[model samples]
Target chain A: MHGYTANKDDILKRLRRIEGQVRGLQRLVDEDTYCIDVLTQVSATTKALQSFGLTMLEDHLYSCVADAIAEGGDGARDKVQEASQAIARMVRT
Target chain B: MHGYTANKDDILKRLRRIEGQVRGLQRLVDEDTYCIDVLTQVSATTKALQSFGLTMLEDHLYSCVADAIAEGGDGARDKVQEASQAIARMVRT
Candidate 1:
């Protein structure tokens, strides 16, 4: 089992906000809002999404990765390796 | 000012462990260690670092971005915009 479990409701709530922000940006584009204004809203939405991603990743590390490392088994070893490669991919982008 | 600020020491501590893990992988490669074992370590390190990135990103959202959105000013707006672009760029990769 993946050790990290996200509260579905909270995830939805954050995501909903981001969605709204994105829609607002779309509206701004439709209405010909100032470039700076649209960009600002875009920034807010992106940061929010990134924040959500961060929380999930953090939980995975503390709950899953750390636990796997402590247990010291083949399964644990495999999980740790999987996590490392996944992160390297994340950073490389 | 960027609303999110990192605890430098903690970041360094996490990074140091990652550094050690990477070095281990290097050794494994040179010595022609088991591929599976090396890949496993790589996965763990990647996840750990990704977790760190997530924490920083999350903090930036709750601490800085949220505050900026609430305040409602030119500066706040600009910051929000900056965050959005950064995040979008992040997702694209």
Candidate 2:
């Protein structure tokens, strides 16, 4: 099974909520809501995405990375590198 | 200025569209859309996020990484690592 298969439903639900938040954000922009207010929504949305990304990362580590490491050798190295790169990306975000 | 600041508006626009797509996916689930159909929408949403991620990565590379490299030494090394990790994460996704 895919790494995210276990939490697929939860992930979708969260993304759905984030989707609503994004729509609200668009409405804020459309109505010319306060600059700071819009920014606040943007911040929230960004955080939501970050949170979702982290959860996905956790799933990947536990499932895919764990599987790769079990296989050993190049598989292990690749998985570690993959995890490291993911961390790096997340930090930048 | 932040790396993404240059393309902030465009990025926002793209995110807004993706946000709508996410909502549509939610609707698909809520209305009991077909399983494969919902899965298809899910795939699209994932791709949208990935595309957004890549664009953000590009912006980071051009601005933040460029700045770090210009600074030289540790800064460059850190930035290179940062970029590599990001690419790894993207590939996994």
Give the i-RMS of model 2 in Å: 8.9
Q: Candidate 1: how large is its RMSD?
A: 15.2
Please give, for residues B1-93, the per-residue lDDT of candidate 2 as tens digits: 556665557767977887888777667555545333444454455556666666666767787788889989999998788678657655644
lDDT by residue (A1-93, candidate 1, tens digit) is 332223545544554565455456456545545434543554455455445555655666776677777988887888777767655644553
DockQ of each: 0.03, 0.10
| Per-prediction tally of clashes | 13, 1
User: What is the per-candidate TM-score for chain B?
Assistant: 0.73, 0.90
Q: Model 1, which residues run further than 4 Å from truth?
A: A1-6, B1-93
TM-score, chain B, predicted structure 2: 0.90
Docking class of 1: incorrect
User: Pick by DockQ: which candidate is best?
Assistant: 2
TM-score per candidate: 0.45, 0.55
